[model samples]
Target: MGHTPADANRDALRAANLRRLLNPASIAFIGGRSIAGAVQRCRDFGFTGDIYLVNPTHAEIDGVRCHASIAGLPSAPDAVFVAVPAVQTVSVVRDLAARGAGGAIAYASGFSEMGGDGTALQATLLETAGEMAVLGPNCYGLLNGLNGSALWPVAHGAARVDEGVAVITQSGNLAYNLSMSSRTVPFAYLVSVGNQAMIDVAQLIDAFLDNRKVRAIGVHLEGLTNVHAFSAAAARALAKGVPIVALKSGVSKLGAQLALSHTSSLAGSDALYDALFKRLGVIRVKDPVSLVETLKFLSLAGVPKNGKLAALATSGGDAGLVADLAETHGIEFPPVTSQGRAALQQVLPAYANIANPLDFTTTPWGNPDAMRVCCDALLSDDPGAAIMILDYPKESTGEHPDCDIAAHAFADSARRYGVTGAIISVFPDLTPPDHAAQMAAVGVAPLQGLSEGIAAIGAAMWYGATRSRILEADSLSALPVLQAGQGTGSSCLYDEWDSKRMLAEYGLTVPASELVPPADAPAAAQRLGFPVCVKVVSEQLPHKTEAGAVALKLDSPQAVAQAVERMTQSVAQYAPEVKVKRILVERMASAPILELIVGVKREDDFGLALVLGSGGVLVELIRDTATLLLPVREEDVRAALLGLKLGPLLTGYRGGRHADLDAVARNIMAIAKFAQAHADRLMELDVNPLLVLEHDAVAVDALIRLDA
Candidate 1:
């Protein structure tokens, strides 16, 4: 996304009026008889709106009144669907805007997706569309199930539901595929935002929030345009009791390149998007199936107040299967209390295990009363949610009747106890559509696949919990109002000593140090104290130790002199043209408890972000890091630290002294504030090996890359 000022109010108005445009009483379809135009959309959605066709070659389009051009319309239609060649799209949109069309979707290809001249033509289309909000100059169109209004090109199978998930996708084909998918997830709206010249996905999301029937919003993105706009809108959705799920493709460099060529939009850093999504209460999923499954769970069950989950199955394998996958997905299965176990013991035979993911052991098969008793005992503990595992018979063998008894037992038990109940089929294809519908009618979801169902439930619970916190904390109020403008100075790197000095100004504890030319290194080391560390200072080298430019533990002045000589020679050997300008003489501090890395770097789309993880020489090898957006509190840093693999170590592993975590948290806060202050001039800041001792944390090594 380009750097642009966020306009929530102006955008809100455009989005608010989208209801009229999307579900307009009248629509003028230009290029009436073209491929997948006017005729297909009207029939696809069963649209009963007044349709006016415009084509010079036809007197009428298939019994519908046809005008020669836009000028011949009887009245200014609220919406216009343009399906013309790429060259004619700009003029067509210009005419619509001239006559005051409420909105227009230009369903044409060969825009920026074609590159070269097409990019120029797309720009003209945006310039031509003055007040009219055009969804795309090259896209499929919108599918509005709630209002029976669709601008989509092909047949989209959907029926109106009370409230369903709304989806917005950058790829027209993806939206088309989703519409045609056999998944049981009902949809309220499907918007295909291709080559978003005027109204991007973020703006469209703001529009969709107006519809009270929208349960959740799912987005399929090639890339994001205007992150702050998304942030603002997502915050609004969070406030409005809306959940957002995003399946963001193209996170890899090669994948991003393809996305850029396909959409003419830059795939900004995925790390930035990840940080922002988690911060803003968005559930990020991997694929379209997961997106739909997750949304379905959210729409049906909402968020569970607690995560203590339980599972029931006739087979021990199914019980263990669910328990294993649930753990992998972070779903908890709370243990049954001794009292609850006693109750379950009575319901089951001696062989049946009274445990979470309890196996009923087929002892009560063909007996709904016994099944109900077993379920009631488990529900007595009042687990947040529960699922019963059953595999329906494909044929009417003698055993087919048992499946119904199990299903009815689950439905009856759940309704009686008022627990959120779900029936899981071991495989997706096991449950027939009719049987699934029957379960849903009884207030039980016939979820397919154990892993998929468990994952959806876990995600739904997490989103619900996260949204409540955001609403309570009013986190939107905490998001930074970015400081505008760019720095004029060029970027330059600073050596460790200089970097530490800058950090020390903000109250960071650094080892006692001095900067001096190599010839005076001995005196500097003596003044700094014995057992000093010497390093050749050169900002040109990003990594000093790798270049053999550092020497540690010099207990005497002679040792310091020899160390400086060796470091200077090593540095010159590594980079022959580079000069050893100075050397840093520092006290050899005692070995600390742990080494940690803390860094701040500006992302193109997400602004400044911080990274904290394992540090020292194995920083990259460890690859255990957490990324967070700026303006974080001490508690936020502390929480992030505790979540890391290094967390247990920080709490004093094997009876070691607990590092001053409070002081570390304060240090992070101070450094973050310093980064914010110099955001304009700073590009990157790192304090790797921020040593944590028994009582104090110190910056043993530092590096600052400034945008000058």
Candidate 2:
């Protein structure tokens, strides 16, 4: 169902309330001594806000006078931390809402996440909160580093930052752990959205986008409650030039199962999430470390204009390692210009390799002037970004002024050239925190660890390029309406003949065919052409070749008749129940340049998705495919086809005939349009081995399942 105007107004109001809750002028802790730590944290963070304690049992708790009840508080607080039990949490929330409070954090678990009675309690909590924003019934709550307010229940390691990345996660433990990261990721806020009973990750993202201090948003998602809302919020971020980095944890089967039991989060198709992220320019990272590192790079150095990078290292081994890792991450190192190499020759020793990922040799290692000259030469080409690998020595070892000098030179040169840059450490722990902070001050990302640094750079490059494309195209303005499917009804499968007939109306080319009785198959084949294919027309047998119900290369009437007889016997033996009454006789297609699969998968949450991949018998074995949400354009289809392993074949691999790619894309778009038209009832559709010939694309075999 679509959201009404009233719903929009309520959402706007809740967003306003959320702003006050996140950065409150006054905070109230409505519990006993258990919440004293939380109150203390706010004080330690330098939150100059009114703090109120409410407890009927104790006159004084944590050296602060306690109120008898919510009614006894001086005035409605901007934010409330309800540490009461699950059943009482709702009443506390109701009282706060009645007092016109901004928002509250339900810190106790057992609601909704525990199921049964807990689910009922959660519904009441949501209804009671009404216009007031609620964080979670089971979460640890939020830390606002921008305003120096830590509403969190436990001790956290985050410090105040004027501007930085905001990290939001479904797991409070993950949020807590990320707060303690020593990687120098300037954190503006850390939010743990537990069950998402009232406010979800999408709403938080939307709210964060309004804050100028939030340079980027990093999210750790087990699953999404609202895919559409997330897409919209991500698009807004992309347009506003604030990147979103995601760490999704439910890719594996066991992990998905665990996610469901842990938080009642349904780990929907990961591929669909990939498509959604790709569409909105959200960068996806693998681990928590990468998440922090990527956000650090984005927040500090910002995104590069392109994937091209210029790397510098003192040792040959470090240079080679950078080259290999850059290649692995799809980072390009455009060769240094003649001007750059000529300048490098003047500063460095003759043995130094003057190239991109330049090994500037140990001769100029300790010389700051030579290092700066080499850095200047490399940046002369105006590469999209640059990185200098420098690992600091242990403090016990010595001062290690060489690394510091090299870092300063790189930082100064990058600033002079106005290029995005990073000083990457080979080991995560080698970079000194003081040095990292100094580099960050000059707008150079002090990235720790070689592999992670390059990965972060790669992610930034992808975001830069993809963000430009999405903003220019404006394709994510709105998602296609999700079509409601018939509830738990038996599905009817369309036989090959019928499926082809339906597809042909939508501009897909299909071979001339006739569906006749099995006895008349030979006559129909003779009328169609000489060399034809015959297949038993039974909805039960979707895979005719596996059932031996299909015969190819029937060049004569006798061949057709014998094939039909064989197919009938094969079907009887294979099923012993299905009768092969009708047969589809079709003219044979010429040898295809390449075979491709065009399919439409209807998912419950994401709606229709178009799947394109290498087709034919090895489709499953090859397992090469790309998925896109439906209502796709022709360019989208073409790009997906080109991304496949067999995609090169379409361009005439090894001097073979080139398939008409435009024609192929058109055929796929036709299938997409057909899927959109039937989105209300279509369950699934497959066109296996959509033959890509030199001149045209044809759907030789097809099937469709619809709610009956």
Candidate 3:
């Protein structure tokens, strides 16, 4: 799904046809135990849709009329919940497709999850079932609370809600765990996109984006089937004001392997996903609890207008806890205005510390009107959001009025000032379940755990600010689409001289250089001038410096000639197989204020990606890099460069070594354009030690590997 001609149209149609699978007028079941469980689930959830069971031998199942086959059904079902054996599931689904059945959930696990043979079987299942949106051949199926149409095949502890966050997960158990979380997450719908045989997470997200009933989306992912489609859907979700919070599990090495074996999904590098999430304005959570709690808070409190939040803590310990956690999560608590400080001083006790997380301890604890006045005075400054930390007294256990004043005061202040409000408990268990419902009743989220609450609030504010940025910004359709490979197998490696030559053709700054045989090294160096660098150029040696094939600061022709001979001998000792055929001679480059690494490679999952980071030997150790998909703007390049920890050094470390960022940006954009244009042929391009001087940037060393 590259920015190619027909991809957008194809994706548009695919997204348009994805909604029919979620809502079904009538559903048919094709197995026994699963059918019974589904029936029980439907009864519990109050689904009124017609349910028809199918089995050749049974005239009735669970005391409901059963069908002998697809033909015996009263009419075409909008969705089919198929739980037959693995081999026969595809045939039955194809038959349903022929009969114009709306959609299906194939809950059999023998498909791609098993390995190569299973992958082939799943492929055949998809090829045979044309235009019929089948959820999976290995899935737990869909749960819909919005319409009370439950095709789920297990007992779930979920309350029917007309509006809540829609959760989609690659793992069915994760989806179930989220639905049954004691955190009291408001769940409108939950979908398990196992193997994504027909309906992937991207399409589900796209469908959910248009359903205004879905307030937000919480996604649990192993890996994405389509990054391009997901990017398009994410941008739409942001623009439509629906925040998406994702917990990605397949980021580590072991987790990636497990994901591939589980669903035949390719786990691209985690850095790329980070960059993608940032570009699409998504908040990536670390674990499942974070995912659930964040969704719960967002559903009740709503996204704040910005990331600036004013907090309330009763004691010095609680205030310090808020400050530490908020700083760690990038949540800003800007200093209150002088007016706000004056107002707080008048409301608080004489000894209270009047700060952002103001400690107005027990001053107005039981006084709702006085607390509202404190809140109203603070609201006059219009900080993005507000939260109050309070642990309900242990004596109020099992009672409805437990901490009623605390909860009501928090909720009313938000309502009175039109700001989102939340109540936090230092420990998750301290926030009893009975009071959770009570807190929700007054429109304030009952947050649990100090660190967890702060992190969730930070994520909520990040989404709020990101959404506002998108709604006020330009269309993101111009952002690049990464397509699959097209180059032939003949593409191969180009040595340093040739690589630089090709880059120079694209207007990138490369040192003046020329390639010559070992015998001509002296003449080439003399022609280039004194103080030149000489390198034994070979396709076999990718890291020439590590291989002892490069020599720098050769002050004279004799020095250059001697260095070439020494490099050849060193290469022989390091690797006798490497052929030292020629040498590269060029005038030595003046050192820059900072050196950066710029690279481009085709990732298996995400097509063309440009990687920019701190260069040199520490690149792998530090790993301070940002990956961007191709066809990016110059502004994106500039932002990526300035985002590095080494960025301050380039901007003049202690106001002494300032390099021209505009020049660095210009070179980066040039290389990016070159990579994008040759994306099909270029397998990888590494420009290490890209010199960022006071006035210009230059590629000091390069290596190019073509696609094969």
Top lDDT prediction, candidate number:
2
Per-residue CA lDDT of model 2 for 576-689, tens digit only, reads 788989999999999989889989998777788899999887698999899998768777778888888888898988998999898899889889888988888899999998
Q: Candidates sorted by TM-score, descending order?
A: 2, 3, 1
Could you give candidate 3's per-residue lDDT for residues 14-96 as a string of tens digits?
35435656777787888874476677677678778887788887887767777888977888788888888888998998888
Clashes of each: 0, 0, 0
The true-structure Cα RMSD of candidate 2 reads 1.8
TM-score of each: 0.92, 0.96, 0.93
Worst 10 residues of 2 by lDDT: 478-487
Summed over model 3, clashes come to 0
C-alpha lDDT (0 to 100) for residue 581 of candidate 3: 88
Ten-residue region with minimum lDDT total, candidate 3: 395-404
TM accuracy, model 3: 0.93
